[model samples]
Target: MADTVSPRPLRRRRMAILVAALAAVTALACWGAYRWAEAEARAALTLNGDLRLGLYASSIRNAVGRYDYLPFLLARDHEVLDLLDAPSDLRRDAVNRRLETANAAAGSAALYVVDRSGLALAASNWADPAQSFIGHTYDFRPYFRQAVETGSGRYFGIGVTTGLPGYFLSHAVRQGETLTGVAVVKIDLEPVQRDWAAGGERVLVTDENGIVFLSSHAEWKYRALRPLPGAVTDRLAQTRQYDRSDLPPLGLHDGPLMENGARLVSLPISGPEASRRAFLMQELALPEFGWTIRFLSDLEPVKAEATGAAILTAMGILLLAAATALGWQRRQTLRLQREARVTLERRVEERTAELLTANRILRDAQEELVQAGKLAALGQMSAALAHEINQPLAAIRTFVASTRLLAERGETAMVRDNLAMIGDLAERMALLSGHLKEFARKGPARVEAVPVARAMDRALALLASRLREEEVQVDRSIPPDARVRGDAVRLEQVFVNLLRNAADAMEGSGDRRLTLTATRNAEGWEIRIRDTGTGIAEAHQFQLFDPFFTTKEVGQGLGLGLSLSYGIVRDFGGTLRAENNPEGGACFVVQLPEAQ
Candidate 1:
């Protein structure tokens, strides 16, 4: 009878344990699903940003190329017809023939001659030969106004009478400041729209007033454009490229639209002739014209995938909870029997031991991760630093060899020259050592009044060996007593970094010269290090001062020289910038506050 009573309680306890386990597993699954969904959304946003920037750049380049060519066409057509004195019936007939030839040659849809009154006198396509155009005035048209103003070529958008959506290339045919007629070439919008719509995304080309001039979807063509519904429209409007205001109040969001439920990304194209600040929701631009192209991508498929993953994760968690509940029920009776002898202190001790073991493992893992990060950073900088130090080291070796040879010869004059070289080399060595010391120097820097010329001298001294080794001539134009308030050591470090960088830049060049100039500006003192070395590519200018980013060979530098130098200058309330010099090579400018 006791055994039977125990079995009954055991069965009830097992059922209770099963229910609890199922609930826990279900909750865990739901949590995991939520986290995964959030991550997927973040990843999608990142991908969108990268793709938008790349495509936008490519499209802008293409548009600029096309726009530049349009001017050439206008010039060519104007030259061909400018030889004619006056508009005669026979001459008009010849002009019509030439217009057809020019249109075909220029790949333009229509070529025509319009009088000052905006009447079409001759056209390649004479489909609608209207006598009314001869007296009709087009002085209000953009192309007409531009031609009259500039006395050359201009671009104009489509108008109501044109019937076709396109841009016009027009040039004023002037006979000694007297405007005779306008030579116009029309470029149909279909080709550009077709090219832009090649990717599997909706594309819209619009005018300044949000009029849909061209679109991949025919339904949208000629339609009055409306803002896409949902947070995406707001995101597009809030982008720095479009909206100039700080940021939108609601911020940006990613997802399907409430109206059509289509996933999309909107890009704005801004171009000239459009309003000064018109925004395009597309992927292309005409910088000269200030036109923008907008490209939108649908996100439905990605959403579907995310939804499926979330559902699967939830189901898996529910299954895990069910299994846990079953296991818990099986141990309920045994656990209950043991509970009678177990005390809270014993359980606490067991838990404490488990926690201690986990903590030890975690601490070991964290230390390893930190060490790995340091090694990675070191690896990146090794090449740049080696190159930096190698130049001075090589110079020191050369000076030593030269001095030894002079000593053996017993030529006093030659020995003096060699001795001077040795002294210069030693000063450079000191400068380099100072730079290394500054890079490794941590904590707050010691500030003091330092003569600007002295700081420049120290930097020049540090790079002298390298400059000599690379055959780079240095011209210093620093004034005496040019002092500034800063840490002497840190200021020297800044100069050393800049001078070394200039030397490295001129390593393999024929015109290996560096110019160092300092002058007092309105703000304070400005030091310029200009070199005739390989100029920096526009792409790499911004990344030059980033820590551990190097363009040097392996084991030569750590890419930290400039980055460290930049920090040191900034700490003393100074600014450092790099730019491509007009004559050749690159220039680094360091500006500091005047010393009291």
Candidate 2:
């Protein structure tokens, strides 16, 4: 009875095993390579474009510096210095002649001076019929006030005399400690504008007030990026900055932040040269001057990169297929040699081996679902990082003001202490700002042995001010020696987000309590964060971890905290469970495998 199987049965089993393995390999090749190829190609293209943009931004920053050098020299000029406090027609003429010579030599629009009372002292174009500003008062201008108050100011505006827009560079004219007047130099941006137009590349530079000071496109000049505040608009109009120009906001579709963490927008234009459907835009901030530079890139290079990746993927699949076919052919030859002597018992054994291999393949597919869910949840962490950073920044400002008052009162020792505290606050803010970039958004998918208690401590430290503000009570029972396989910072982010969410939920509740409890079992360690507040609503519970889903009112939240935290935990090979507590609040449980 045991010898009932025939040689034909043995051949069929071998064929079945080969077919299954081939199908599995084929599916893996097609599915995996597509995603890998696309991501790699896109990343490479993006990096290239970003590098190019960074180069141009640096150039503009340096250019601004170079253009201001002569204005700084004019501030220190002996002729201009003498005319500040005492200006007569004879003295003004001498200063004007000297300024005119320098302005022409330096290729500036004009060089002028203003006293503390805002009266125009001298001008480089004093003799020009249509472009002289010899006796106008510009005390109402922001640049005039900024230079008087802060020692230096840079502003862009249309000249009342020349009727042309230009950047005004002003430096305080001070003899010893006594302030006298401001040395003003108007720089005509024509040189930069010409370069931008000739380069055939889209370039835009917006000032601190969000107005476009420089752009290749004529229509975009003097346009605003954001709607100007009414006060700012009135000031601009009163100062004659744009000189009767109606500064409208630019039209565009705003996009997500780039890898470098800058806002951007796509400006659509139609022409023969504008072949790309839409521009890939990026904004680079000139933090020193409170300016933003934006560049729009063509899509041809990225398309080429994508094409190359597809070709490579196809070639790889074909090579793999050929190699696998060769391997099967050789294996078939060897099996055929033994076919003549194959027994009924061996045929039954082959069938059992094939079934076991099939079972193993199915188990692996289920494991990949965890990674899929984590990826789906990762898209919402960007705004969460911005939200977390605000708290630390607000604290830093408080510390700085306190430190300044102590210093002014000659309390040096206390001042030093507060300064150190402020530094700590600043570092904490930076850490919060970078967490999204380093932990979730840019982190490689992996797990590591992490100190569970240390992560909890860090999260608690960040929420210290919030906890005090909300008057929330905390109860902790986590063990100091507990460790798990996960990323420490990311795990800390998970707890920080959870704690903050709990604080928001309990904002006005009378009994605001947060409980942290940890326990270990055969499977792994479990951490529970329970809050005494209104639990998540039944209808919204399922979507709690979905991207852009929030239960809070508009402007209160971006609905990203729980989703980001969920993704972080999942990426660490852990489970993040959310439910309504029996005690009348929300409970989040984090389950992490114990470190080997």
Candidate 3:
């Protein structure tokens, strides 16, 4: 006796409701599965990226530290070169003893003493003693040339003698600034190769000409290296990381093909000499030697996992929809109608909430992405900046230490001059440090009154230890009464930076002399720093104050010191200038308003 209904219409209505429910469930399940897969993939990729980068960085640090230590080791054993200069028979005995001692300490393959003419006079290994190497010419060796010409040290590739892959670290033996001979130490590449193998990564060490001298993989040993296709080789020439795209497709497996209609992610391993565009994928630079390391991995398993998850989600949705349809069929007609309306309303509300949540998450992710980008940029700048700052600092330290030694030895006149140079160097360092701090700061400058001479003194004091080690001469001509009304800290910083620059200018030059003169002029109190070293080029004078305009080698100078100092001086009512002195050197002049 209930309201009569056509069976066909009822059946049609039931089918429509079941279909709608099934579709809704399928869409939700698919979306959830997609999000889950995306999250997992992102996590895995991030982890992989971190692990590879960490390993690369650690390896580079080790290499740099090892190389830096080489010079010190050679300097310590300088007496061996003298021993090799004796009669051939006596030289052989002394040289062998010294070689054995050095070999024991340095774990080197062989230690050889080469004469001024690049003749191997003595050998370390007893099996091939000095007699075997006596009169053997090595003028063709790069390390020998570097030692004779540069009068410093250099790294050379494997030798023709042993036929084993190695590096020759050569130091010049100077007799009062005259190159007497060279001390060559041979370091085998086997240990470093072993290190690379243990790290689960392959490393190929090449020279400037792309000739591979050492490789972790034995098969690649002594191979002539070619650029990896698309790899960034410039930074790699020092140290760097590239992703898959940065490299040629020759050596790597293809990454996972993304399903779920999302964009595919390709990992790039960059080469050492890649370009800026080449770093579109993940890239890091090694500013030291321009070397690059690339990391690549397969992503097929990730794609398969995502695809399977999507299919499983679709099947689960179908089952859920079937259950929903059965529940609807079991209900009374009136109740079924009521429940259907409620279900549709609930689904709409739930969808709206999900959309809102997704929007918020997307916004958060965007912000995080921006911050990450900023940090990455900062990381790239850090190495170059540190290197630039360190050079001046090292120089300043040398000058300061020299001044201290002069003072301790009761050499008042020399001490005074050295202190002045120390002060100047300190000012230069302070300026550099200030600029670095400001560059990294998120705020404005804080100014205060600072005494000029006191600032200079503080700068000198900071470098006291290093100056003594280098035995550089310093001359200060500033009156103790000099003072400047400005941001005391910043004023000192400027002077320190300028002084440090002067000290750096004298590095490696046998005649290390720095002169500082401070006097009251019509404009203000003027301080001039002069160095007796290779003068600046006339062409580069204008660009000296430009940011990142350094004439130094990679990682040596950020070229921001003069620029920052100029800004600071102008802010505090001062002037800074530079010029080539008539006496074969460079001079920097700083003028600050006299304290009222």
Candidate 4:
């Protein structure tokens, strides 16, 4: 009787074993389903977060780039240059008006010009007695120092005068080769942050040092994501980047990394365990601006979804085991299992629809960014391109007027000549328009062996009327073999710019002489255009070739002549420079490499 063991007791022991086995299988199935669902959910969230992060970065970049051209453009203004050249009450008044108007039009927080010594000469806020930046010295500011050192600079910090946080964009203002002053435009980025907050997005932007300067949450501003090094802290202090703001660590703890460089992070709120919240964090780098953007999505929903999936899986497994053990209720168990599967499928379908919506939104954002970029580029090149075509248009106007007179006088030969000249001018205008497109695109210049004398002759012919009007005595001295490796059309433009500048300089001078001399150098042929006028100021000589650097009044030039000429010559493996001649005049030297 096996120690008097009852059959009922044996059956009960067997049933207990079977129940234990089913429970173990159900638990294992639940864990597997939870892990699989969690992984899938994290991957989807990271992908979607990456797209949102990119869109945020694009918006910030576009905002910064939009104002990048403003400082340089304002620096080129004649009134701003005048204020720096000769500081006077009247001139300051003019500049104040100018800056105020420009600031309003540009929608910048403030616009001001600081002399080389960092003294504020004129400001847009001159009217605001409380916030006027006039007479302040900003030499200690890194933005001013950097602009003086480099051609341009950007900085983010609290304003010393206004005590408000803003981004500073500065450009070195030059009259010829001299850095006379700095043109600064202070932009308030609070609006951008406000937009993020309005969207209810958990986003933050950190500088190179990991200190959050902009955020959707106001409490996160000026806080460090991690413990900052001593050196970085010291640098921030020196720059006054945050201006007396305390940068405490956010105590971010990393948990596990997911696909596409996203990861789980736990941040403490206030309490012990209840205060901790998990976030799926994704970061995108704005390399151009040396900034990082983070997008945080709450993980509570994902956890809930994974738990639901696990529960469904566990229930199905238990029902299948029960069905196998109890043959009578097998049909009912199967029906329950099918209903559980249908519920799971419906949830999955809902998730798929959400992902599709996210994808469409991202696509639309990318398209908008592309279109905005295209429009901005067109706007920047429009002014320079217009300047290039204006010269030919003016000449055409004069020729057309003269042709009308000749036709009325029955001078057929002269009229025929004028029509041919008009045709040539039209062709030149077409070529100029095409070249401008290439220049804007930064396409390579057309390289060929170009005759220097012939190019100069064409340039002189184009400016013949201007030279006559100014009563300039032109002299040319070039060897018969004055040929160089260059683009003929571009070289002609360079010559025309130099000659036009020389004539302008000789204006109101007693002795107006334009002398051209060419000589061979070790590198190439050196051509000098000397103008007998009040020679360039010693201060301006160094910046003569810099782009948008001009001494002429506004509307007369866009300060692109020498800069464009320098680039064209460099493209042909040549050099362009300016200096004061020993004999009381300004001289321009263009050297081109010898023909191969």
Candidate with maximal lDDT: 4
Model 1: per-residue Cα lDDT at residue 381: 23
Residue 499 in model 2: lDDT: 88
lDDT of 1 by residue, 412-473 (tens): 78878767766765665565455444544433556678988887775676556566767788
Any idea what lDDT model 1 has? 0.59
**Which lDDT tens digits does candidate 2 get at residues 1-596?**
57587989899998899778877765666556555654554455456456656766765654466458655666777777878867778888888877776565455678888888878888888897677887788888778999989998988788777788877888888989998988888877666656666556677888878888788677788888777899999877888888987888776667776565534456656586763245567677888778887777654444444444444454455456555555555566666635523543364465446445534533342232111111111222334566566655766776678788988899999888778867876776666556555544656645678888888886887677668878899999999778999866568778888988888888878999999998998768999999998998989878888754577763466556787788878777789988999979999999999988
> Which segments of candidate 1 are over 4 A away from where they belong?
1-35, 38-42, 45-73, 76-85, 126-137, 151-162, 174-181, 194-200, 226-290, 322-596
Using lDDT as the measure, what is the rank order of every candidate, best first? Answer: 4, 2, 3, 1
Per-candidate TM vs. native? 0.40, 0.47, 0.41, 0.56
lDDT of 4 by residue, 351-469 (tens): 55655664565445334323211111221233445656777788889888989999999999999998898898788888877876776566776788888888899789788888888
Model 1: what TM-score? 0.40
For each candidate, what is the lDDT?
A: 0.59, 0.72, 0.60, 0.81
Q: Which ten residues in a row have the lowest lDDT in candidate 2?
A: 369-378
Task: List candidate 3 stretches off by more than 4 Å.
Answer: 1-43, 63-78, 83-87, 129-136, 154-156, 198-284, 304-323, 332-596
Where's the lowest-lDDT run of ten residues in candidate 4?
A: 371-380
Instruction: Report model 2's TM-score to 2 decimal places.
Output: 0.47
Quality of model 4 by C-alpha lDDT: 0.81
lDDT, candidate 4, at 449: 84
